[model samples]
Target chain A: MIKFEVDNVSVEAKEGDTILGALRRNGVNVPTLCHMEDLAPTGACRICVVEVDGMRGLVPACSYPVAEGMKIKSRSPRVIEARRTVTQLLLANHPDDCLYCSRSGNCELQTIATELGVRQRLYRGQRATRKLDVSSPSVVRDPEKCILCGRCVRMCEEVQGVSAIDFIGRGSSTVIGTAFDRGLNVSSCINCGQCIVVCPTGALTERSHVDEVIAALADPDKYVVVQHAPAISVTIAEEFGVKPGTDADGRLVAALRRAGFDKVFDTSFSADLTIMEEGSELISRIRNNGVLPMITSCSPGWIKYVETFYPQLLPNVSTCKSPQQMLGALIKSFFAQTQGIAPEKIVSVSIMPCTAKKFEAQRPEFAPNGLPDVDYVLTTREAARLLRTCGINMERLEPDNADTPFGERSSAGKIFGAGGGVMEAAIRSAHFLLTGKELSEPKLTALRGTKDRKEMQLDIDGLKVGVAVVSGLGNARTLMNEIAAGRSDIHFIEVMACPGGCVGGGGQPIGLDRESVKERMKTLYNIDRDDALRVSHKNANVQRLYREFLGEPLGHRSHELLHTHYGKRDVLR
Target chain B: MTTTVDSILAEYAGAGRDALIPILQRVQEREGYLSTDAIVRIGEKLDLPAAKIYGVATFYNQFRFQPRGKNHIMICRGTACHVKGSAKVLENISHRTGVEPGRTSRDGQFSIEVVACMGACALAPAVNVNGHFYPKVSPTKVDRLIQDCRDEETN
Candidate 1:
């Protein structure tokens, strides 16, 4: 431990700790804009500058190492002045449209400016007019509002391992953009929304479909139906000032109904359907000597990543569509048939904890006869906003159940919100398909946490099966490389593009830290622990759906509606 | 005849990212500019993203994204030249050719660029076209230079 004096208070900090880390540990609050946890500090923003005892000028606390006997004044007058100046300079070039910005209430820059008492613009200069990039169906880029914090750039290149955007050009002309300053749609972007999650300003946001959804809701001829992902119910509570991980599932359904959806469905029911199809596919591949080590295709971002980077492994990915798309297809075909409504008149809308689902819903494969299966997608944040726009407070609503036929889901489907939940769910069903009996203890504790990667080997009916679950595209890339190099121990793999799976997705509530994501995962596990129906194969509604409409898993009707394939996609690097 | 991006990349076989600059330079030398296709090929060879490679390439002003025109024009905006009204000469050339500095004309016949210094401060305002320098250049001289290049193209 190193002893230091912060604000005249004696403190002890761990050796090799940065001054910012030590000060934060000591309960000293020093504001920072460009600093991200677990990332190498760039010290680009001098907002965390402190008045060190021996330093010639104020030093940035984010990168400066804590030294023994070092004296620092984090909130001294000189330090405050320096921070104010830096904030003023950033604000000088920023747009004055915060009232109209998507991040109006939650922007870090506005909060920091308010804290620093920057009431008025101190320095005004000619603002550089930058073009807005809205080519991607999922994410939008407003370069005029960007403060050049480089958080989105680092989050894209370092954390996600998809360098679709970077700092282009030099000095004052530098702006974060895709290759050749082209549209992000043509770039190597997986549309994970991780970049939008890390951006401090209103520079990055999901392409909103709330207006069109409202328009659909008002149309008397359109039978607008809505489905909410499993992760949405857990994380949407945070947007309403409720504690993180609070299961507002029933309340969310009630609120959606209040917001004028003709029918509200649960995507978890389709997730159970995914497990049935994907698990049967896995068992068949094992029995028939098909593609070994078949990877899951639940995450759209991971699908695009594979399509762009590792096109050779396209055949290895499971042919099952994601829960969002699966439910959309079912809503148009089965649900519409059951209701005696025309498929074209039924508008399928999904509320997801993802931005990539927007891109996934728009894929040409998901559209049949040039008619899209899913009409609109709203992120959890956007859903919260829409509910608020309709004067529907989740806290005040009574708990309500989802509509019948596609609402009932097993706990195994509910756990699909977390990273390794899919693998555990699939293993339970795959074991049943192979041995015709449920496991003694269905809870695979090995695959139940928020770790980046988890693997387990199981002996199911004397067949040794190896399984691995990985979240975040970077870790997926590493495991993929190993698999490509002929490491063939694993028989099935589950990959989610966002770290900690959809609970930590790019389209979840913004400004969420790792702790919130862990809490959401814990809530999903808690739901699974307490629920009665824990296996996807035992879901009565899913079995009834097969008997009523689809013949069986991977059957002709199922293949037409619930399964899809991916091909090589050419992108800008 | 110019070499292909594949042949140039093959010469740097078994090399890492440290060979990026040299590979880009070689491709630029052969192709007259760093085309998007060339950048993508280099990224595939070096195991880097095209955006990162483009970022690095853009940091240095030597890399050009557009192909050079038939008549390449470099106008000096050095300390001495700016004082001698090179800005007006630049404005005149841009007005005549409809090409901004660091951009090529639509017809692919003329390109304009502004350099910091050519170390010829003694000439004050100077313009260099196709490796030939015209010292103490005025607006009228720029017009005449454009006409001479056009006349040469007709010939």
Candidate 2:
């Protein structure tokens, strides 16, 4: 341990700890902009500068290591001036449209400015002139608002392994741009929007369809129906200040109803439906000498990653559409038929904990007769905004339940929100599909945490099935490389592009009561455990739908509606 | 025509991420400037994204996107030249060529470039035209220089 003095208070820190870490541990808060929890500190943003005794200049507390007998003043007048000046310099180049900006209240840069008492501009310069990039269906990039902290660049390259964007120039003329400075749709961007979630300013945001959704809601001719993703309920609380991981399904439904949705349902119902189709597909593949390892196709970001990086694995991907797409397809086809309404008259919308779902909905295959399965996709944040815009207090509203038919879902479907949830859900259903018997009391506990690549062997009716669950594209790339080299004997691989499945999705609340994936996982798991039905096959509504309409899993009707094909793209454009 | 990028990429095969900069340098050297085709081909060869290759290639000041002209013009903007009003000389040349720095003329006859220095401090405000050097240049001198280049080209 090393001893240090922070604001004249004697403090001891572990050896090799940065001064910021030491001070933060000792209850002395310091401002930081370019630093994230687990990322390597670049000190690109000088907002964390602090005074050190016997030092010539103030050092970045985030990157500077604490030395023995060091005297650190994180809130000294000199340090405060330096930090304020840094923010002032950043503000000089930033756009002056904060009042109309989406992140006006929540932006980290704005918060810091308020704390630093930056009431007026101290410096003036020519702000960077940049065109807004709305090329990607999910993320919008406003380069003029970027402070060039390099967080998104590092997150994309170092964390996600996409390396889609980077610092392209030098000095004051530098700009963050894609390869060749082209639009993002043509680039390798997966539309994950993790960059948007991490951006401290309004430089990045989900391409919102809130206005279109609002217009649809106000359209008297349009019978607007909405569905929330499996992860949305657990994360809505995080966005609404009602404690992180609170299952706000009731309030969420009430808000959606108040917001003028004709029907508000759960996507988990279709997740259960997905399991029926995917489970049957996995069984048929295993029995009929099909592909060895079938990768799950739930996360659209992962789908795009595999399509761009490893096109050869396209065949190995299951032919099932995501639960969101499946539900969208059902609402338009089956629900429309039963309600005696035309598909076009019913405007299908889905609230997802993902930005990539917007891109997925826009996929050409999902649209029949040029009408998209899900007409408009809204992020959870957008849903909250809509609630506010409609004058619905989501917090004070009484809890409610989802609508009929598409409302009922199995616990297995609810677990699909977390990292290993899909694999476990599939395993239970797949085991049942194969042996016509359930796996004992405890589930596949091995595939339940935030581990990078979890591999486990299952003895299911004399067949050794190897399944691997991996989150984050970086780890997925490693597992994919292993599979390519013939070093992996995995039978089923589940990949979520974001770090912790849809619970840690890119379109979740930005810097608002952010909770650990483990905590989020607990909410999903509790929902599953507390429910009466545990397996997808036990969804009575789904069973009846199969009995009445679909006939059976992997049937002709199922293939036409539930399953979809994927082709390798030379370029996304 | 030069050898295909396939052959150039074969030299840096299996180099992966580390080879990106060197391969970009080599591609720029061979192609005169980094082309979209070259960037995409290198991305395919190294299993890296095309945007990533472009990103790394752009960080350094050495890379250029536009092809160079038949005759390249370098205007020194070092401390010595700046002290002697090289900025005025640059503006004069740019106006005469009808192209800004880092751009080629429409006729593809002349390209202008700005350099930090030409390492000729003794001859302040120096300009390097193609292979030859001009010292103590002025706005009128820049106009004469362009006229002289055009005259030589016509002959």
Candidate 3:
């Protein structure tokens, strides 16, 4: 540890800690806009500038290393003035439409400005008019509101390993853009909205479908049904000032019903269905000498990443659709049939913790006979807004159960919200399919947590099976390269594009730190631990659906409704 | 054309990202501008994303993304030239050529660009066309310059 004097208060921090890190550790609040935890500091924003005892000018605390005996005044008058000037400059070029911005109440810039006492615009200048890019089905880019913090760029390039956007041009003309300043739809974007979560300003957001959903809800001709992802119920509580990871599942269903949905269902039920098909597919591949090391296709962003970067591995991906689409397809096929409603008149809406599900729902394969399976998708944030718009406080609502038929799900399905969850769920069912028995302890402790990559070898009925789970596309890319290089130890792989899987997905509540995501994951695991039905195959409703509609797992009807294939996609490099 | 990029990339075989600038420079030099195909090929060879490659290439003003026209006109916009009314000279040249700065004409015959400096401060309001410098250029002289280029093309 090294000793430093911050505001004349002695503090000790680890040896290589930056001034910002040390000050933060010492309970000193230093505001920063361009700083991201666990990322290499760029020191682009000078908001964290502080007065060092011997420095000629105020130095940025984010990138400056803490030295022994160094005296730092983090809130000195000069430092405050520099920070105010930086905020003023950022606001000078920023748009004045915060009232209409999607991030009005939650914008970091507005909060920082209010904290710095920047009541009025001190320096007004011509705001550069930048084009609004709304080409992608998932994300929206309002460049006029961007402050050039480069957080989105770094998150895309460094964290996600998808350099779909970057700082184009230089000087005052610099803007974050895709290749050739083209639309993001044509770029190498995997539609993982990680960039949206990191943007400090209102520059990046998920493309909203709330208005369309409201229109559908009001239409008497349409039978609008809604399903919420497992991660949504856990994280949506944060938007309502509840503690993070609080399971508001029943409250969320009640809230959706209050919002005028004809019926509310759970995506976890379809997640159980996914495990049934995906697990059976894994065993068939193992028994029939099919594609070894078959990768999971639950995350649409990972599927798109493979389609764009590693097209040769398309055949290796499991043919099962994601839970969101699986439920959508079932809603139109089986649910509509059971209700005696025309498929065209049924509007399927999904509330997801993912932005890629919006893109996934719009894929051509998901649409049949010129009719889309899922009509609209709302992020957890958007769902909160929708509920608020309807004057329904989600926290105060009475807990209610989801509709019958497609509402019952096993705890194994509920755990699909976390990273390595699908693998655990699949292993449970795959073990049952292979050896006609369940694991003595169903909880695979090795396949839990938010680690980048996890591996486990299991002997199921004397068959040695290797399984791997990875979240974050960068880690996925590394493992993929190893597999491509003929490392064939693994028989099955599960990959989620976001870091911690659906709980840390791109379209969850904004401004969430890693701790909140971990809490949400813990909540999912807690749900699994407390629940009775823990295996997907044991879910009575799913088994009934297989008997009533679909013949069996990997059957022709399942192939038609619950499974899909991927092909090579050409994108701007 | 793709074969040319492939051959150029062959010289940098077994190289890494350190060879990016040199590869881009060579490709741009050979193609007169960096095409999308060339950039994508370079990205593949360097094992880098094309967006990042484009980002790096665009930071410096040495790269162009479009094919050069037959008559490439560069107008100096340095401090010395600006004080001597190079902006009017640039406008007059753009008017005569019917092309915006840093863009090719519709007919692919003329292109215009505003450069920072050519190091000929003594001759203010300078214009260079097709590697030939015209010192102390006026807005009216832009007409004659276009005519001379047209005549040279005919010859």
Candidate 4:
């Protein structure tokens, strides 16, 4: 530890800590627009400039390292003026339609400008030409609002390991775009939308399907049915002013019902269904001398990334549809048939904690005919907006249960919201299918954390199975290389493109740091622990679905509706 | 099998990620611009993403995506040349040549590329045509410059 002076108060800081780190630790808050806690500080925004003794000019506090006995003023008059100037310059070229912007109150730029008291734009010049790129299904790019902070760029390249978009032009005309300035669909972008969350301005945002969903809800003929992903119920509390770590499961169901959803279901039901199919697939592959290290195929972003970057691994990925797609197919096929509603009239809308689910829903194969299995995919944020529009305060609603038949889910399915939850869920079900007995403690505690990669081996009735769970595409890439080199010992792997699985999905509440993601993850596990049925195989509704309509786990009807194939794609295209 | 691009890529076959900039530089030098095919090939050989390669290539002004014309006109618009009415000269050239800065004519006979400085401050308005230098050029000289390029293409 070293001693330093911040605002004339002697403060002790860790050795080799930066001024920004020390100041933040000491509760002397300095404004920063370009800083993400997980990313390396590049000091691109220059909003955190501070005065340091012996330095000729104000230094960027984010990247400037502290020394022993260093004198630093976080917000001296000169420092405040410099920060104000930076904010003013950024605001001068920005669009004046803050009231109408989608990210009005949540924008980091607006927050910093308000903090610095920069009410007036100091430098006015030629603003960047306004161009909207709405080519990608998940994310929208409004280039005119870009402040060139490089947060999106860094997030995509460093965290996701998909260098799909970057700075394309030079100087005043510099633009961040995909290769050759082509549409993101044609580029290597997987529509992950991590870039959308990190953007300080409204430059990148999720494409809105709220109006269309509302229209569907209003349509008399359309039976608008909604299903919430396992992660959505855990993370929706943030938008309702509830505590971050609180679970909004019952409230979300109650609110969705009030918002005109004909019937509300949990995706965890199909998550349990997915476990049955995926677990059976894994066992057959192992027993039948099939593909080893069968990778999970639930996260659509990870699926697209593998398709673009590592297509050869497609054969190793499980063939089961994601719970969202599975539930959509079931809602349109099985649920529609049982309810006596035409599949066409059933507008299958899914409230997902994922942006890639939007792209996945739009996939050609998911819809064999003109009508798709799922009509619209709304993010957790969009669903919250829909609830607010109908004046349904989720926090105020009484806790309720999801509708029956497709509503019941196991604790094993609920845990699918977080990283390694799928693998943990699969291990429990696979153990029962393989040996006809449960593991002493069902929860694979080793694979429970929010780490990028978690690996553990379990001896299930004399059959030793090695499983690896990876979240965040960057870590997935590292594991992919190992598997590509034929050096992997893992028999099964679960991959979620987002950092902490669906709990940290790109379509979840925006601007959520990893700390909040961990808290949201706890909600999933807490539900898993308290639930009566803790195993997927024990979900009575899932068993009833199989017994009534679907004959077996990997039977003929299950294969037709619950399974799919993948084709290779050229990344350059 | 022995195409110029193939040979260019073969030289960089084993060179890793750091070779991206140099590979792009040489490819652009030889091909006059960085084609999508070339960029994709470079990415494949270097084991890097095409978007990342394009990102680095675009950071440098020397790289171009469009093909250069037969007559590459290099106009200096540095401090010394701009003060000597190079803007008007540039306007005249653009009007006569019927092309914007950093673009080739429709017929592919001529192209205009503006440079910061050509290290010819003594001339104060030097315009380099291919390798030949024309100093102290004015708007009146624009017609002759186009005519000369057209005559050379015809002859």
Candidate 5:
């Protein structure tokens, strides 16, 4: 660690850490736009300028490293003026319509501007002209609101391992876009929505489902059943002024009830069912030589990445709908039959942390019973907005339980929100089914952490079970490359497109600091540990669903409702 | 200066022709200029052996691959750029050519590139066409004077 005195403040930080890192660690609020803690600093925004004692000019805290015993003035007059000037120059070219912008209350620029106390731009004239591109089903791109920090470009290239978008043209005319300015749907974009999450303004946002959700709630004929993803429960608490990683599961159920949801269910229950189907498929593939390296198809972002970038690997993906879709299918068919409600009156709404789920729910194959199984998908942020609009103070509300059949889930299902949870959940059940001998230690500790790639070789009864789990599209690329190169020998693999899995999804709360999200991940794992029903196969609700609705894991009913197929991309070709 | 240029060029050569992206970036970074001859020599060293390098250089707007003036200015013309008053800034810089983004100026005093989305949306109608990041850029503030490669001032 390196210790330094900055303007009479004693601060200590690890070696190789930037001045910004040190200052942020000390709770010094130095504003920034282009810089994120997890990303490399390009020093493009010029917002975090700080005055150094002996230095000639204001230096950007983000890129500059602190030397031993460096004296720094963080809130000096010159530094403040420099920051204001930079923001002014940025605002000169930025849109003045913040009131109507989707990011109005939550915009980083707006927050910084208010913090800096600047009301208006000194210079103004004709802005640049370019039409907004809203062609993609999942994301909306408004170039006019863009600040050109290259966060989306960096996310696409460095994080997603997909260089689908880039900065094209030179000064003043420079813009971030797909090659030849093609619409995003035409590009190799995986619709992961990481770009949308990283955007500091309204440049990119999820295609709004507010009106559709409201309409569904208003229709008295419809029985609107809402299912909450495991990750959303942990993150929705932040919107209610609660600390990060607080599991507001009970409050979430109550809020959905207030939002006019006829029945509030937990997708974790369906997640348990997904494990039964996917786990059975894995064992079958291993025994029948069905396919090697059978990949998990839970994350739609990862699924699309496979379609666009690794189409040749399609045969390896699991043939099960994500837990969200599986629940939607069950709600419309099995739950409808059980409740004695007409299938047509069922309006299935899913609140997920995943932005890609928006597109995944709309796929043609998702409609199993001649109707869209999942009628509406709201992001975690949207769910928070709904709660706030309904005057539901989530923090004050008493914790309530989820509805029957769909509400009952296991620790295995709860863990699915984190990176290696799916692999751990699958192995627990697979070991039980294959060996007829339950695991002595239910926690598959090897497949239950935040590492990018985790691999374990377990002895299940007499046979060896080798498995791998990976998160983030970039990490998935590295894993897939290993498999393609004949370097991997794992039997089963779980992949999530975003780092830290669904809890760190692109549709979660905006301005999500990495440290805060990591804490939430720990909470999710704790939720897994604290529950009595630890395994998916052991969940009473899953057992009941299979017995009453679907006869068996790979039965005809299961195949018709839960199974799916993959094909190569026609656009990339 | 020669050592600085040589070492930077050597880094690009080690990366190969696919290194064209980083090479063009280095040339722009080192000399603060991208001469056509520099592009040709870099292409020859990388063994591309085709106009592919030059085509790529012109294809994406960021690659200058040509010598430019001391001051490089960029004005954003993205959707936010339109909404943020980036056109007036463009008009002010229109007095120069060849270095005016797609085309920089005839004189070696300035060069420009208009980019799409710089991800600084809250400060939209932004411009980094040059190496400088002008958040809320305005047209009236376009007039400027001379400078050499000495400033090294970012943003």
Candidate 6:
């Protein structure tokens, strides 16, 4: 650590840490938008300008390094003026429609506008006009709201390892976009929604299906069934001002019930069903000389990344749709038939911690029946929006259990919401199924945690099964590169596009640090531990669904509804 | 000599929509006023093709895509360059070159372009004459910078 004194404050910081980091460590709030903690500092915002004693002019604190004995005035009149002018220049081109934008109260641009005291636009003749890019299924782009901070670019390239978009041209004419300004749906976007999470303005937003959800609820002839993803239980509390990582599963079910869904189910139950199918598929592949490195397909982002960048690896990806999609397919097919409702009258809804699920639902092939498998997808954020619109205080809602027949799930099912969670959950059932004996404990510590990348090998029935788990697209790139280089000997791989899986999804609450994302992921594991049935095979709901409805894993019925295929894409220009 | 707007538009749209950037760069690279039609036609191809393209084209100080005189002069307006009296340097360049930024000499011999944050902070008050980095430039050095470029053009 390097010790430095700035403005008589002695601070210790890492060698590569910027002056902004040092100051922030010492409780100094440096104004910045381009300096997110998870991303590398671009110094583009110019909002963290500071006055140094000997320096000729103000320097951006985020990019400038702190030298020893450097005296700095963080909030001088000159510094304030420079910062305010920079903010004003940014606001001059920014759209003034803050009140009606989705991110209104929680927007970083709004916070900056309040901080800078920008009352009105100074340069009004003609601001740069850009057409709204709403071609993507999951995310929308309003270039008018873009400040050219390159946060989305950095998030896509540096974090997600998918450089599908970049800044073209120079200076004021510079704009961030996909290659040839192609529609994102046509581009190689994985639909992870991390870009929306990092975006400061209304430029990037999730595609909403509120009207469809409302239509489902209003249809007296329809039976609306909702399933909440694993991570949603932990994060829904934050929307109600509860502490981060709070487990409000009971409250979430109650809130969904109050929101007027006919049945509030658990995706964890479907997650168990996924394990039964996926686990057996893995074992069969090993036995029958099928694909060796079978990759998990829970994350739409990872799946698209493979399709776009590594099309040859398509064979490695699991043929199964994610648990949420599986539930949607199940609800529309077997559940609908069993419950005496027509497939058209069964409106399936999924509460996911991801924005990519929006795009997943829109796939033409995803509709098993004449109607789409999932009628609508409500993100964790949208669910909270619905609850708030209904005037229901999430914190005050009475605790209630998930609807029966589809509600019961195991601890293994619950853990699938996080990184490495599926591998751990699958092992619990697979080990029992293969060995005909239960393990002392189901916690696969080797596969757990929020590490960027991890590898482990386990001995099951004298067979050494090598596995690798990766969270974050950058890490996924490293693993893929290693595979490309012929160094990857792992039998199975699990990849989540977000840094820590769905707990840190693009649709989750913004402003969570790595530590906070880990905390939320831990809550998922804790929920798993508290459950009596920790193995997927033990879930009675899953067993009954298989016996009465689907017949069996990899069966004709299962293949029709639960499995999916991938196609290659020309994402890069 | 006068150039038609059609040729410039065709050249800007020749490669791709993003081709306008290098086209404008080439225009500024070649003759030295951004043809307004070049900007308009480039916008037309991009679909967002708006008049604001002109505003942004003019906003940043570094664009000049037109025919200039025999000699073209550029002065650095970067932050460190600004601190070392680049505004005064601009005044002196205007005095010597008989042209301000985005302007050409009445005799059609010299054009001027000013830029921001040229990445040469260590050498404050920097300038590039005919694609050569001239660091630590001052008002006194302006006359020589112009004369050297003019001398090269004549030679």
After superposing candidate 3, which stretches have Cα over 4 Å from the reference?
B95-98, B147-155
DockQ-better candidate, 4 vs 5? 4
**TM-score of predicted chain B, candidate 4:** 0.86
Candidates sorted by DockQ, best first:
1, 3, 4, 2, 5, 6
The numbered model that scores best in lDDT is: 1
Deviation of model 1 at A91, angstroms: 0.9
Query: lDDT by residue for model 5 over B1-155, one digit each (tens)?
Result: 45555677776646665677887777777775555456446645775422334445556666664455556666667787788777776876665333445444565556666667677877776766345565676654454322222234332
What candidate 4 gets wrong by more than 4 Å, as runs, is B95-98, B105-110, B119-124, B129-135, B143-155
| Alpha-carbon runs more than 4 Å astray in model 2 | A512-515, B1-22, B43-49, B92-100, B105-110, B119-124, B128-137, B140-155
- Residue pairs in clash, model 4: A293-A491
In candidate 6, what are the lDDT values of residues B25-122, reduced to their tens digit?
Answer: 65554545666455545554554323334434554566754566566566778778898988998888888877867777777887777777778888
Expressed as tens digits, the lDDT of each residue in A1-573 for candidate 1 is: 899999999999999999999999999988999999888999998899999997898999999999999999989899999999999999998989999999998999999999999999899967999999999999999999998889988988888899999999899889898989999999999999999999998999999999899999999999999999999999998998888989999999999999999999999999999999999999899989999899999999999999999999999999999999999999988888888999999999999999999999999999999889998999999999898888898998899999988899999999999999999999999999999999999999999787899999999979999999999888999999999999989999999999999999999999878899999999999999999999999999999999989999999999999999999999997
lDDT of 3 by residue, A54-97 (tens): 88989999999999999999888899999999999998888899
Task: Tell me which of candidates 1 and 3 scores higher on DockQ.
Answer: 1
Query: Looking at candidate 6, what is the lDDT of residue A183?
Result: 75
With a 3 Å backbone cut-off (N, CA, C), the pairs that clash in candidate 3 are none
Query: In DockQ terms, which candidate is top?
Result: 1
Where is model 5 more than 4 Å wrong at Cα? A1-3, B1-155
> Candidates 1 and 4: which is better by DockQ?
1
Q: What CA RMSD would candidate 2 show? A: 2.5
Interface C-alpha RMSD per candidate, 1 decimal = 0.7, 2.6, 0.7, 1.6, 8.7, 9.7
TM-score between model 5 and native: 0.80
Question: What is the docking quality class of candidate 2?
Answer: medium
Better of 2 and 5 by DockQ: 2
Query: Scored by CA lDDT, what does every candidate get?
Result: 0.93, 0.88, 0.92, 0.88, 0.81, 0.80
lDDT, candidate 1, B1-155, per-residue tens: 23499999889999999999999999888888899889988898899999999999888777888998899999999999999999999999988999977778989999887888888999979899989999999888988999999999999
lDDT of 4 by residue, B1-155 (tens): 12566788888767999877787788778888888888887777787778888888877767777889888989999999999988988888888888888778888877888899999988979899998999999777877887988897788
